[model samples]
Target chain A: MENREELKQLIARIKGGNTDQFGVIIERYQKLVAHVVFKMVTTEADREDVCQEVFVKVYQKLDSFRFQSKLSTWIATIAYNTSLNYLEKKRVPLLDDVAPQESPLERIAAEDNTPDETAEYKDLSALLIEEIDRLPVQYGTILALYHLEDMSYKEISQITRIPDGTVKSHIFRARKLLKDRLLAKYKQEDLCR
Target chain B: MSIKHLSDKRIQEYLDNKLRPESLSPDERKHLDSCQLCQGTMADYSHLYSGLAQEERQLLSPHFTARTMAIIRALEKPATAISRSSLFIAFVAVVTICGVVNYFINIKDILYAVEAFSLERLLSGSAFVSTMEQWSSRLGGNLNILVFAGLLLILVGLIDKLLVRQKANRAYFMSV
Candidate 1:
């Protein structure tokens, strides 16, 4: 509550044309912006640039903010849009619509060996990261923001511009997808043992 | 007795802690206790959860805020330039508006010129020649009514170009 008040006051100062105060706002929201940008923009070179671009948009559009949501949520929206636009300009299609080329189901389907028999052991985190990245973009983004960024479903919904129910559904589905992927790669008997 | 397994969603809810021991019916609890498949599924979820629990948080570069502030300062530079450009556009707009007003204010003279051009006079080559001569002499060869209209069109075009450029500048500023 007090923190929100401080940010509101600082935003008021920035909007009042005290451009110097923008630094504090950027510092406060930079992580949130980075998380959103990193999730959406696949180009490593473009991520930081898009993150900076989001803040530039925020500074310009600050006066129009209606206080409908938290300032972080608002910044996340800009970050999400800017990163998306960057991808669009690069002629990259929105990844949410396409099943990733190498989904867990596909990988398991392609393997000649049974799931339990030939477990070429890899680091669990490495496999998880690979599988997570291979999920649909929406799932990857919602999961990253939920688990990696530690955002609430409501916050994720606000940032992603999805309904609250959709946010919950995506988080649930994303987790299930990851677990299913794990289940495909290893046997239940092996895991239980 | 054949045991029916819980659906994956229900099992996940249990693993998510949305289900507690007290919440389940005794039959369900008892079944889970002996069910190897359920326990294995639970263990798989536990491993997945453990991996997720250790998902690394991405950190921005230490200078991220500074870089952003720098870009903001760069953006402000163009905004002030746009304001100056807008003032220039406004001045041209005023001039164009004054040209329109001045033209309207001389509507009476224009109407008289039109009134003088009867069909008979237009049909008569001699009358047409004389009338053309008279108007050209009156308005001067350097600036005829036709030339004046042409110049007004050019000025309006200039204003349109300025407006388009201003709109584009504003768009870029917003995009940045």
Candidate 2:
């Protein structure tokens, strides 16, 4: 979290034509940008491209930024929107549209992996992440912004442009869904460990 | 006595720390303390929360910053050039305005004045003086018109400059 004065000074320098100063801004916020991009963009190559494009957009549009929101939130909003645009271009479904035929646990358990292969990567954390990835795009994004980035509901609302209540509902539902699937798949002892 | 289980909302609020156990109402608190089912739910949520918080971030290439900067620097040059051109346009607009005003105010008089200083007119002092007097009178009578024309030209030039810069900005954004 940059203090207001520091942010102002940095922006002033960038606006003053110090191009190198923008590198510092990118470094500071790239991780936050990556979290949003990674959650929204699935492909490694496209994620990297979209992440760079987000920064490019940010740099071009920085002059118009009036500090109405935190810089990180503003950058994250760009990342989210850019990823959506990419998804749209590729004709990818932005939301998970297909209803589940079976429980998430059953779906994972039913994968064609052999018993030994499944046993090899059965970490609870990995399973939870897989479940999260299977969630609806908005749900997964809200979860990443909320839990991973430690963003507040209001900030996530700003990024996703959803109502704060909707953000809360999605997060709760997503977490509950993750928990239910994990509990169904693993014993309490294994999860705790 | 019938026992009521905690609502999912209450359990979530507890795990989210929106309502800590210490802050729970007496009944909810007593139930949470004695109810194995509620305790297990809370534990599951706690583990989920821990896993979420500890989830690893995907690292960008180590050269991500340098590559992004290189692209920015490349794009920035044209932007800087465009802005410089805009400044030049503004300067030309100002100069055009001043030239128009000067042309309206003095070009004819100066031309006549130069003609008056020719050898033929120089030999006749009274004709040169009369021409100078006529030029001053003409300027005084058309002062309002001169000001109005100058202001109109300035407004036109300003609008033109603004439109050009707007187009340039749009182009810059599109290129990005």
Candidate 3:
């Protein structure tokens, strides 16, 4: 059966008082939830705590889940809102500096052959993520949903509760801004070198 | 087809494949193909897209799954316990309702028996009537005491309910 169907079955069982079935559901979507949460929160610690809270809320409100969207989408929405709540509680500034840790591309560069592999696509990935991080929260969110998460506009609309037209507009603006920022970064890097 | 100005936003839409090729007028396509700036912009975006695709595959920390599972287990325990407790509370409520209904129905017969004994004494003689009169006056005094006691109990219950409601409101605000 499809993964969604399998998840629905597990959810049904969990709601029917079979708590053990929840373990399977958790195992299946854990990474997906963690990734989404990590994208929203600043620190690893906050991400961990919020991820736990999201699941707690999920279990507590499992009976109320209407299955209007896929389980993953619902979980992502929860993760997004939970991280936002965490930010609100901490009074952290929005659209702040990107996390100071090495970008994922940089981490990947550190793991393998350096000079030869670097020729493939030098600083593009890091530049793209930086530009995306600089975008407004709504724009950044839509870009993440579209490019990173591979969700359709309809799915993004459902998760974000935005109109499809707005989703399209945000994505359009996000990509334009990313393109400008990347080009500017490339020019600056060239000038620096 | 004449060359028309293409907005930067439209260039982005074209790069992301959000704009259908058929939707672009012939002049727009011609400009896209011939304009060096737009072409260069498209190449840069394409390269960025390809690089992002590769980076997207990097899995999160190895322990991510384990940590998430631990959380889910912890959360599920409390949730299951809560559901079970709510079910138990519902069961208790149903039993209490049944017990109350049963007592009201069964207790009526005992009440009638007591009334029958009182009526029999009244029908016997004048002495019984005088005794009943005294007893009734004593009962009237006791009933006054009981009515005052009942009002006091109701007042206490109302105060308790008000205090509980105040506490609940405070707790709710604090949680928010």
Candidate 4:
């Protein structure tokens, strides 16, 4: 956040009729934007479109972004909402309760892991990435923002608009679910040592 | 202490390092240290914690910034375009005002028609005053201009509504 002043200056320049300067904002935050967008939007083609749309919205609405939070968090909010809107329109399953949705562990348990695909994974990190992908959009997104993006619960709250407690709860539940599945597949005694 | 075990929630806070050391009572800390269950659970959580923080990030397409900038270029336009809601409000206002003006000219007829116990006169007095004879009766038979202007506005409003809805539908389908 030390770059806060510099980002403010850049945004002021963009708003002061130097519209081409918007590219710098795009360049700086596109990865963070992608981190939010990719988790919600599952389809590649639509994911690209949603990411582009998030920036378009940020550029159009940048004037209204009062320096209340970090610019990255504001851009992240836009990305998160835009991705959710895309999912709703496309009817992708997210945080739904049609049934007790299958966790990665459940699927793994159903499989005969004697020939496990995760055998190709050299470590838990790789297998964790694979499991994260199977998570619901909100679960995957919150985890990515918290863990990979290193955002605190409050920052994630500002972006995702979920309460900070709910953000932590999501992280807790997501980790617990993944851990439960991990324990089921790789028993605690075998791996937790 | 009445409680002999740390709840999963407490264990999570400890794993996240969010719990202050002072906040953890000596009993809880002792219990956690002496408890094999909590230790094993914490180790499993720590592994997940490290994996999540260390997970390889998915990279955006190399040209993602350039593509986004292109979208920004495509979307850039002067801010002078009126919004659809404003146009809708203007349409409703125009209709309301025209109905009011046309009725303002017919307050007497409405009163008389009400007194005479016949609502037909009132019904034909203003709202249905679209014909030439009705126009002559409504506008005092001198300046047909006001009546014609009101009619013209109503016509324009209807056409505007139709075209706007058509444009909106087309845009909706194209977007989908």
Question: Which candidate number has the best DockQ?
Answer: 4
Q: Give the CA lDDT, 0 to 100, for residue B73 in model 3.
A: 50
Look at candidate 3 and tell me the lDDT of residue B126: 36
User: Residue A30 CA error for candidate 1 (Å)?
Assistant: 2.6
What would the per-residue lDDT of candidate 3 be over residues B100-156, giving only the tens digit for each residue? 435443455335435545756557643655554554464544435544645665565
Candidate 2 clashing pairs, residues 3+ apart or interchain: none
**Best-fitting candidate, scored by lDDT:** 2
lDDT of 1 by residue, A1-193 (tens): 2177787898888878898899988876776677667767776767777777788789889988878887777777888778767777877665453434676556665665544444543557867876776666667777767765667888888887899987887777778778877666654325433
Q: Which candidate would rank higher by DockQ, 1 or 3?
A: 1
- Residue B153's lDDT in candidate 4: 65
Give, for candidate 2 chain A, the lowest lDDT window spanning 10 residues.
Answer: A184-193
Q: Write the per-residue lDDT of candidate 3 for residues A1-193, one digit (tens) a residue.
A: 1276767787889888787676676666666666666666756556666766777677878887887777778877887778778778877654453342654335444545444443433457665665665555556666767776677899888877789998888777666666655665554444334
Interface RMSD of every candidate?
Answer: 2.3, 1.2, 2.9, 1.5
Task: List the candidates' TM-scores in order.
Answer: 0.64, 0.70, 0.61, 0.67
Q: Model 3, stretches more than 4 Å misplaced?
A: A1-4, A16-20, A92-122, B1-3, B18-20, B57-60, B76-176
Q: Model 4: per-residue lDDT, tens digit, B39-103?
A: 78888888888888877765677877776665555444212222554476577767766576566
Point out where model 2 deviates above 4 Å. A97-99, A187-193, B79-176
Candidate 2 local Cα displacement, residue A29, angstroms: 0.6
Q: Write the per-residue lDDT of candidate 4 for residues A1-193, one digit (tens) a residue.
A: 4297898899899999887899888778877888888888888767777887888789889889888887878889999989888888998877753134665456665664553454554467766776677677899999989887889999999887889999898888888877776666565224323
The alpha-carbon lDDT assigned to residue A99 of candidate 4 equals 30
